[model samples]
Target: MNICVYCGSSLGKNEKIKEQAISLGELMCKRGHHLVYGGASRGIMGVLADSVMQNGGEVVGVIPKNLFKKEVAHKGITELITVDGMHQRKSIMADRADAFLALPGGFGTLEELFEIITWNQIGIISKPVVVYNLNGYFDSLIQMIDHAVDVGFIKPGNRKILRVAETLEDCMKFCEQEL
Candidate 1:
């Protein structure tokens, strides 16, 4: 299966997050899955791509033309696709992937995760969306979603659209089930 991964372009302060990213990539390879992600050669993105490539896994990178010109595209990926803008990049990634996973990241990662969940909610896509909530990174966000459900802003059933996994093993299990 082709798994779409949304993660940081900039690695945060924690080295463990980078380790986790690499582990996730290795897991994908062990499961015989291909990666479809934002084509960047920095932060967790680069680490994950490298791990997958090193493990002899196929990686498909979808990068925006602007970012590609900025010299952040992963040149060593199995396949690199350049799109005109962020929207097109996301669209193409989603279209090509059979499942989606989100690693801890800043605004960009959150945006991509939410967009995929929203797409599933509205029937634009039915693919599974899993969030790797490592070390409680997404605890507050999960709480906020629960609050939304309580206040009737979001339907209760829709809350299940975002599957939360605290470990790489759990994440892989979810992916396998989805596939």
Candidate 2:
């Protein structure tokens, strides 16, 4: 499977979260899955890519020209595709991925996650979207989603579009069901 991962460019202060990224990469390799992600050689992104590479897994990085220098596009990945901008980058990533996995991240990551989910919801894509809630990182977001469902802002069936997992194995299980 080719899994697109949405994660932070900065390695946050939480060591455990960084560890989860590393473990996820290693597990991806073990399961013979390719990684599709933003091409950044810094923070959790870098750590994840390096782990996959070190474990001999294919990694296809999509990076925009604007962030090439700022995010330090990873040159050591299996394949690095450069795009004109963020929109192009995301389009390429989503097109190439079989599933989407969201890790702990800030604004950009959240944006990517929602955009992909919206696309899936509208029939632009039909793919599994898993949220790796490592250490309850996404508890608040999950609650907000529930609140939305309760308030009738979102349909309960639509809420099933997202699958939350606590471990890489669990996340993989959700992705594997797409097969």
Best by lDDT: 2
Q: How many backbone clashes does candidate 2 have?
A: 0
Q: Model 2, range 40-126, lDDT digits (tens) per residue?
A: 999899999998999999999999998999999999999999999889999999999999999999999999999988888888999
Check candidate 1 and list the clashing pairs.
Answer: none
Clashing residue pairs, backbone N/CA/C < 3 A, model 2 = none
**Candidate 2 segments whose C-alpha is farther than 4 A from its true place:** none
**Superposed model 1: Cα runs more than 4 Å off:** none
Worst 10 residues of 1 by lDDT: 170-179
Task: Tell me the lDDT of model 1 at 15.
Answer: 94
